[model samples]
Target: MKRRLEPGRLVIASHNKGKIPEIAALLGPYGMDIVSAGELDVPEPEETGTSFAANAELKARFSADLTGLPALADDSGLCVEALDGDPGIFSARWAGSGKDFGRAMELVERNLAAKGPEAGRDAHFVCALSLCWPDGHIVTVEGRVDGHLVWPPRGDKGFGYDPVFQPWHHDITFGEMDPDRKHAMSHRADAFRKLVAAVF
Candidate 1:
């Protein structure tokens, strides 16, 4: 049987401003006291893991061990079919040291264009969530959402590659879609649902 997350203080092991709020919002309904690793001055750990799940576990364990509390971490990325799943685990690194996603988005467009017209716009997002207790007990889950890429980008609402990626059956890009709507069907949400089912 999986260990349940008892309501109380939980550390969200991430420093990304955009990600922390999204995660906090998801955990809002649970009524747990949420704090971010950034808020606690927890240094970001090196993501040496080769896969999303491994990275998520690494971050969660790092924070949980240091803070002596339960920690949750999310490792997510965008995978382009034409790019051969490139920028997958390295999604954040694509943004460069300053974390400028606009530049990263442009790079993606440039790479895609270099492939010629026959190169498909097919793409997907992957999110892996890990929950860890201070004692090292952990639970992890992964989720994905399929979509295609677009040029010129879109709304400024979402961060990262949201502006250019439109999910299947949706006419608008994630950046253009309503936050609540995106949260309902996002790759992160999918992973959160699995996490909740397994541990909440």
Candidate 2:
């Protein structure tokens, strides 16, 4: 079957370096010539959505319209059950004035400090991917990984909330794990798997 996305120079509606590789890896199998919004100086739209799916669609649709090409966007964050599922949409802002995951991790630990150990500090990382075409058709997919947060952080590989997020059945954080392993269990992988299936 011919892939709906096809093979072409497409745009990723995000400026984050961390997201590009994942998106590229996911779409590469289908033979896509992926491009990033940053490469074209496309602006990132403010994510005003209350959920990951909404935000992904917002970015993807906006970029697709702006570039007149299919666009892929992802919105992902860590949700800690102990914090009332907090740091959900605010995961990026947990660090306060900047995009500092270190500060973000600190804030999470502080928030859970008073709750004490095993205070349902359980967390899961969620990723939502949106694919939009210039013709106004859009498809979205979501994926999640059950995990927990560890204090003081660990490893130095992955970014954002990676160092602190320990996946189920793993003693090390996502940052500490191999990229292949991380990608296998990652929320982005799950969503992208669904997305590729839909597109193809």
Candidate 3:
């Protein structure tokens, strides 16, 4: 069984500035008083989990426990098929402590090049969402968007590895798409749809 999210102040358990706004947009229609853990000065818990779901739940539960309010958290990253899903959970860590994603994208390209002509550039983005209550109840969902990797990373929009990922049918990378357009078919949006259907 799962608990419904009542319209009230809900904690968004994330310190990433990029993710907060995207999530806020998804939850906006629900009319909840959304608050971010960063805004609340809640410390980020160590992501000790090996998978996205575990990490999302960990963050959500931590915020819920601290604030005594329901919390929502998401863990997302890029997984390259050629890399055998390398940099899955460590996606952010690859950017270094300064969070320099530009260099990180370069690193990804270098790794692919090292694979020679046999490299399979197929890749996908994944997002896992978790909703947690102070009482320890939780609900979770996951989503993924498949695409192939492109060289010379295009566009200057979006964040992370968006510039290098071109979805299956789209000519432009995520970095080239408008925020609203990306939001409509993003992995985060897919997960949000599930979370909305199940919990809201």
What's the lDDT for residue 82 in model 3?
94
Residue 172 shift from truth in candidate 1, angstroms: 0.6
Model 3: per-residue Cα lDDT over 44-158, one tens digit each: 9999999999999999999999999999999999999999897788898899999999998999999989999798899989999999989999998999999999989899988
Candidate 2 per-residue C-alpha lDDT over 1-200 given as tens digits, one digit per residue, 9 for 90 to 100? 33487788788999888879877876767878888999988998988998999999999999999999999899999999989988997788786666888988888888899788768768999999999988879989899999888877998987899999999889999989888788888999888888878887
lDDT of 2 at 156: 91
In order, what lDDT does every prediction score? 0.95, 0.87, 0.92
Q: Model 1 Cα displacement at 50 (Å)?
A: 0.5
Model 3: residue 175 alpha-carbon error in angstroms: 0.4
**Residue 53 CA displacement from its true place in model 2, Å:** 0.6
Residue-pair clashes per prediction, in order, are 0, 0, 0
What's the true lDDT of residue 66 in model 1?
Answer: 94
**Model 1 lDDT per residue over 84-194, tens place:** 998999999999999999999999999999999999999999999999999999999999999999999998887899999999999999999999999999999999999
* Best candidate according to lDDT: 1
Top model by TM-score, which number?
A: 1
Query: Cα deviation in Å at residue 106, candidate 3?
Result: 0.9
For model 3, the stretches where C-alpha displacement exceeds 4 angstroms are none
| CA RMSD, predictions in order | 0.6, 1.8, 0.9
